[model samples]
Target: MDIRWITAFLDFEPAAHERATAFWSAVTGYAVSEPRGEHAEFATLIPPNGDAYLRVQRQEEGPSRIHLDLHVDDVRRHADRAISLGATELVACDYVTLRSPGGLEFCFVTHPGESAPPMTQWDGGLASAASQLCIDVPASRWDAERDFWGGVLGVPIEYAGGSYAQTPPSADRPMHLVLQRLDDDPPTVGAHLDFETNARDDEAARHQELGATVLDTGPEWTVLRDPAGLPYCICGPDCR
Candidate 1:
């Protein structure tokens, strides 16, 4: 894919729409763009500093999840290549909606941009950036899904032990795209937001105070569920 930009969309159903929007807007300190789309269900979190890469979409009904959009120069050209790499086409319009082999939904669309948003600095000196999208793939589909993503993105795939792999951060590439092979099937392929922060504990606490619930804690990250029940993580030890 000749990716020019990327955006991660957080999805929620009608009932949780307002809460999801508010929590994320507060967390990222970005102003929300007016909802667009035919159903008035799309909005962007316009970052104060750099290019915007975060958005929210309201689904009629479904569990809250995140999906990625690859903005390329030629939508059809890149999308055709994506299909050749085993991405199943789900819908097509001005953009192509497709699912990777493991099933995480994504789209190929045209948008013009280069720089990604910079790390947000808070008043207390805590800094962080919504810098990654972690896709959860089933163990059985790991090989195919991993190859599919790497093939389509045309980025070097780096491994972290046996469980995690990621497309290393590139200055002009959008967000860090990661793949996590799960032990068993998860019913569907899904993704979660990952934010890198200098102060993990404090950052997690900040989210908790703003309506997110702590889900679990790990050696390198803290898992949390926003009010919409969408699981996201706060990573630490580095702000990159």
Candidate 2:
């Protein structure tokens, strides 16, 4: 499968969509495109240049969460490939949704375009930027989850440490897919975006100004919840 593009979607409850859109736009330095879809549930964050890699979705149901979209030339072919590697189908239609063996949900969609926004540096307020999706997998499923993504994406698994493994992005795809082993089991496996920053404290403060609340902080990263209550992290300068 040719993984032509990658996008991180911010899924929010219908009631909280507007707040999520405004907060994300402020922090990422992108303008929200006009809504699309039958109920106007979908919109893209327009970067100053290049195609968008971030999108916002107003879901009628389900808790706020992040999911990845892998764009390919043949959605069925790629979906089949993903299923063969232990992904269970969730929805099958014009596009396909699959839950990985470890339980994180992702989808396969036909490539929309070829343009990818350049990796940006901290500009208006954020020191660096959101550039990677970290999938939190239970420790019991760690090895298999790593193998499944590596096989489906055709990328070598690089270890960030004993508990974290990542699939490095190619020149064409700008976002990294990371598998992180959690100490305790989560109700459901899920993913979240990570921002690499030179000034974690300053970035955290800016996020607060935009309606994000600091949930917790550690030496290397700070966990925060967006206005819609989705959790994401801001990492130290060493992150990429």
Candidate 3:
């Protein structure tokens, strides 16, 4: 798949904003961008090529349903930095997963090593530290959603479980695009994975071809409901 962007939909109460921003800033060595309106968001650049960015949004509702797979040359170094920045080192924080200051979760593995970085300053916006975002899907919809992402993103199913599905990154990296199945009625529209394609037409193409249903579409972006009726989108940084 020609996947270009990945996002982590976080469920954060408004009160955690200051601490979350400060924690993220220290981890990235860049300031966190302030929210511009009703929706909460923060971003930071990764410097040099600017091929990608990472972000976190405040979901004042409940549990986040999705997570991101971050690719780093050294998971240890990133984890250490995150700890120094006030991010708790959760159990199993090493090797595979880690949670941020605001309880935003992600996994890191050393596959598909990164190239040398260029010198640059953080622009206080999300950078592409992650290669793929994983959306949680319902068990009944596992195969359906797997097929949807496989066909829409031009990738193959990496793994499937009774309540989980794993997709591979489109970039030249080894990152798992994960999905978790829900058993009961959804309490809230929690977390969601987002993509940044080259254009809106491309997003529409996926919707048309794959069975990805449209939730909303604007001039700058488009929202879609996956097979599980989870929310997802494709938009530029400005839309964040």
* lDDT (Cα, tens digit) per residue for candidate 3, span 1-240: 433334343334456544544443343344455555454353443333533344455556553245554555667765665565545556554465655433446555444334433322324433322233556555455565556445434467765545556665343332336555567534221246555444455545544455466778887657775443446666653332
Identify the runs in model 1 with alpha carbons over 4 angstroms from their true place. Answer: 237-240
How well is each residue in 58-142 modelled by candidate 2, as lDDT tens digits?
9989788888899888889889989999999999998999999888889999855466566455656444667788888887787
| Among all candidates shown, the one with the greatest lDDT | 1
What RMSD, rounded to one decimal, does every model reach? 1.5, 2.0, 19.5
How does candidate 3 fare on TM-score? 0.39
How far residue 164's Cα lies from its native spot in candidate 3, in Å, is 5.1
Write candidate 1's Cα lDDT for 1-240 as tens digits.
357777899988789999899999999889999999999999999988788899999999887888899988788888888899988899998999998877788998887566677788897999887888888988888888888888899886678776899876768754777888988887777898888889999999898899999989988889999889998999984523
User: Which candidate model has the greater lDDT, 2 or 3?
Assistant: 2
Candidate 2 clashing pairs, residues 3+ apart or interchain? none
TM-score of 1: 0.95
- Candidate 2 runs further than 4 Å off: 112-115, 118-126
TM-score of each: 0.95, 0.92, 0.39
TM-score of 2: 0.92
